[model samples]
Target: MTSPLLTRHGAVAGLGPDAGVPWHYGDPTAEQRALEQGRAVADQSHLGVVTVTGPDRLTWLDSLCTQQVAGLAPGESAELMILSPQGRIEHVAGLVDDGATAWLLTESAPALATFLDRMRFMLRVEVHDATEDWAAIGEAVSRPAADGEPVTWVDPWPGVTAGGTSYAADPTALATTVRPWRLVLVPRASLGAEIEARLESGWTLAGTWATEALRIAAHRPRAAFDVDDHSLPHELDWLRTAVHLHKGCYRGQETVAKVHNVGRPPRRLTMLHLDGSGHSLPEPGATVLGRDDAEVGRVTSVARHHELGPIALAILKRSVDPSTELTVPTDGGPVAAAQELIVNADGFSADRPPKPGPTMKGLLMGKGCAADGGDLPG
Candidate 1:
């Protein structure tokens, strides 16, 4: 069954009971439309964005995070990570500063706390679980960011939005930290009326399954599902920007540096354009095979592409060679697929050959940033 988290704001349009876990009935057509033109809104309240502060904030944060956090000015945003002792990712999140306070957003607040607790035992910082204290709404629109109060612009990654509406606690008076921009929205229920009145229009509610599909089509990775205990930053192409190799030690710095310098990870994630064969939905753990019908990898996440038929993400052995065409390893037979360079999958800076050659990914692909969808912010 889909947890309350997945189905909370989402639903199955034609059916009474919505899609099951993994949200199989994800709205591909609607998702693609949201990307291409106009806008589509999604609920992101399940993820928690907590605040960490105190005199030790800067030093403590720098020690706990994968990206350097020592010099962030108030009202600035940067993307960073937390790693397991083995160098695999725990969560890659955004760090928001309002000068006095710093916030971190991740899929699980409890999980995040556990990671932070290890470092906070002796540090003078306090970690607050502020997920319930706030609500989030995600928008993928071609329009520009809101125009009003000072906006906290965070360009942590290539296509992500930092703080469309960042809120912080007030020490003296009632001051709100919010903005109108391209991003996942987190509206405070305490001030729900004020927020609702602020944006009377231009918001759409997303069900769990639909939201998952939209993200997969964009070739984006969510914390737990897209990432796992074993994933390295490079597997998801989240290096340099998210993980700082030159920075001092963190839980998994040595492993990160070793992999980066060695130029290898067991698996390489890529996008696949499949036929959507027999209406067959390949769930995660389903096998991926090569053109010669040999096992290559497995599907991680899938959503029907708005314009490109069936699309999916898979991690295959890096040694498989670019010349090897891939197919779905299934009972019926190998499902034919074409290698699709995800619009966001940037070629390796160290190993990749020059481009204007092998297609540019992420927003720079097909029609540029507007190809897979639009110039919208998410």
Candidate 2:
């Protein structure tokens, strides 16, 4: 269940889903600094691990999710999503293939495994919830694999991978891209001993609070914190990594194509610079209000960065003006917030052309072109 290290010096347990792990050590600021400097390792054992085996694994996965993985090379890391028929994200995972097995590091392991198993029809694929056998450790920089050459999933966030498009107006300018992060799967049985060894070797032990602060600063989104039932990749600007516009048919391809070509996401993700003068931070799900105190959005993730003071990621209606100063209702009162655009106000990919006139089938069949402003990018 939980990391043995949770009992060690200065450890404080996390809340909700993070209850099984450490929230922080005594000095959260120092822990955050150490993590950023790469002198610390975070125990993320609470994350789930799933395994898929058999010859048809890659191709089968390619047919199901949002990313193109049929040709995924061994050790090459990827981020993928399983979307509903309406193109709403249902599950998200960090994937890495080890030639013989596809290891998925996910926040929703049992549900993901169950869905994949139901889709396996006559295919040779086998899905297993390997959480009992494996656990994850977080690192800021990629490290050499230990003795087993454990599957490591390098995060490809904020990068426009092949066949994917970016919604961020300035993808290269994102602060998130510079901070490299990855998850290393380790044998669960020896996890505590392994962490102890790293500590003995001079690595400082940080916790979720440290890691989360860096994430908020970088504008990185986690499914657990960021996603809602109605979330779309476009809203979160997830198209930069998760969705492949040119990939073969998948469950939600129609909706995805329609949105990118003819529609805009109803909402957009925004980073809020909050007034840190207050003693406490607004909790997740706190209502975000615009001019006249109108409800405009909901706060998704909140953190106090070592340098940035108080910051949060919120999903706001696309119609909300990016220049508008907002407020979040906290126990003390309302805290003022300034918006830092994460997804463009227009809520579409940067490179996508003007709206097309043709039906979904016509666009898929390559019918309409110049009428939509220009040919769609491959």
Candidate 3:
């Protein structure tokens, strides 16, 4: 499944899920600058595509996902998550509907499609893994489809959609974080040609390195990097786009409701500004240590930004103070880090209702990830 675009001069293959795609095309810093300036296109053909059709597609999805999708309009896009019964995130996708078909762009398409297929007992929905037929490309903004009419899923990150609330310590962060992201679907067969055309038109080609850098800087979460068996929406600040507060009962609605209404997430997502004086960057799953030299969290993703130098996203125990300076063990030694809070220690809705009786707060704070399964993906 290696991308044909990888044939481009200077293309270097990525690893893991990003395998078969370009990690960078010689110069990542310049590529990142072009991408942020909206003059670059990044290859994202490794992403999975799932198509759901039939008259009941929207309602069936709405009943199962965290987002309210039943009334999704023709060109509207939204993010959704499928959670385990305990409210742990299992799958996440960007959803968009054409007049007749619903397209899901995800990192876990096979699993998502299989889950959707099994859920269709008597429902009229038909789910198909269209990953082989379609490929995706990332852009700073939506562009005209080449070859045919392509579906685009616009990212709604860092935005509080209707029935959603924020847990960010700085409310202005949501208003100020600007990532005009879009994923455009194209015929898989023509992807190389399409990119060549864009290149001819003066658009620089970026890679996963640039995209990951931008995503980390924006405090955005990716399923392949951020999620684990115990990942809760509140922990990642994902409720802003993925969960509908007032949606009808979905698989994990009860836990979702309880956490936001009366309890806080045991773990919080944070941004780490790493010491850039050294050449070493911490790898994903690197241990994050507090001043006491004790493990407090794990780095989920890491990237060296064009301007921000070394930065990473980590999930820490909610008790970790925002002012605490931390360190991450890397191959080149320990790198000093400073925390920028993505989700606060009080990882609950700002508009949570006052409730009486014992809350789940004590239970969650005491157990942490061990209560859900010892380890949450770093």
Candidate 4:
């Protein structure tokens, strides 16, 4: 899965599963700046690509995911979540229909294909793992698309789409407003040349860290980092784009409706401005503590931005006050964090109080009885 550009650029490769990709070409800060300024390209070929063929593709996928895709138009972008029967997120993908096939961009392609294969029972759709055949290249919209590249999925983060809602109380903090992003799929063989050409044109090659930092700043929740086996769409503010509240029935629809209508999500997603004076970052799974030193949540993602020093995304108890100063347990003991609300503290429910029942005295008066029956005789 390693890209040819990795060696050409003398990248300081990451270890283990990230062996093939560059953690940074040389300067991570400069790379991040390039990305923020729209002068960089990120090799996202590590991501998985799946393609669904046949006429029933859209309808079949729509029935299995949270988003409505049956009527998707060519080149239009949408994201969906495959939830378990209990309404927990199991899989998520960015989708685009090319008039003939439905392309899916996911973090785990083989697993998605396997899951879809199990559901194909007599369906006309054919799911193929195109990971080996394709590569994903990402850059900000300010970096124009490569000419003749036919398919690109523009990110819809921090934006309120139709049938969606925004949970962010402050619009200025949204990332997309600062720099829009897009992911383009290219043939694996051509990926190297494409990257080289961009490099030749003076564009810097950024690593995944740069993109992740920007994503965290935007309050964007990613499936790989933010989701667990029991993550609900409401908890991550994914209802803003990934879930269509009025969409036709699908797996986990009941749980989605129940949580959004009458009940509040047990946890809420929040952005934390970490106190970076410690010069240490809290690793994922670091316990987040309330003012009372009670474990309220865990940090899901953390990053140091070129401007924002250090930041993190955490899922805290819905009752945790947004104004409360919290702390995250780090190797250096603990780090102070200030909360910037992502999901509302009230948990986004619209339930109302029950109507008051008629008082006994009013009922008796309406029945022509005073204070009590036969009160006049008494």
Best by TM-score: 3
In TM-score terms, candidate 2 sits at: 0.92
Off by over 4 Å in 1: 1-10, 13-28, 141-155, 159-199, 203-214, 329-334, 342-348, 351-378
Model 2, residue 178: what's the lDDT? 58
- lDDT value for candidate 2? 0.85
List the global CA lDDT of all models: 0.56, 0.85, 0.88, 0.80
Please report the TM-score between candidate 3 and the true structure: 0.93
Better of 3 and 4 by TM-score: 3
Q: What order do candidates take by lDDT, descending?
A: 3, 2, 4, 1
lDDT of 1: 0.56
* Model 4 C-alpha lDDT versus the unseen true structure: 0.80
lDDT of 1 by residue, 197-218 (tens): 4346754343445555555554
Alpha-carbon deviation at 265 in model 2, angstroms: 0.4
- Candidate 3 lDDT over residue span 100-168, tens digit each: 999999999999999999999898989999999999989988443333457888998878888888888
Q: Kindly indicate the candidate among 2 and 3 with the higher lDDT.
A: 3
lDDT of candidate 4 at residue 8, scale 0 to 100: 53
lDDT of 3 at 225: 93
Q: Alpha-carbon error at 158 in model 3, in Å?
A: 1.7
lDDT of 2 by residue, 1-378 (tens): 778878998999988667789999898999999999888989999999989999999999999999999999888888999999888889999899999999999999999999999999999999999999999988887543444677788888767788888777556668444566888888999888878888899999888888888887777788999999989888888888888899999998887887787666788888999999988789999999999999999999998889989999999988899899999999998899999888888666887766545565354424243122233433
Tens digit of per-residue lDDT, candidate 4, span 1-378: 887767855587654334567777778888889999898999888888999999999999999999989999888898898999888899889998888999999987889999999999999999999999988888887333344665788887767667665555554456535767888888998998888888899898898778878988888898888887768888888888898888889999887875664455777899999998887789887899997899999999988888998999999887788899999988887899999888878665322223224553243223322111122110
Candidate 4, position 152, lDDT: 87
TM-score: the better of candidates 1 and 3: 3
Task: Estimate the TM-score of every prediction.
Answer: 0.71, 0.92, 0.93, 0.88
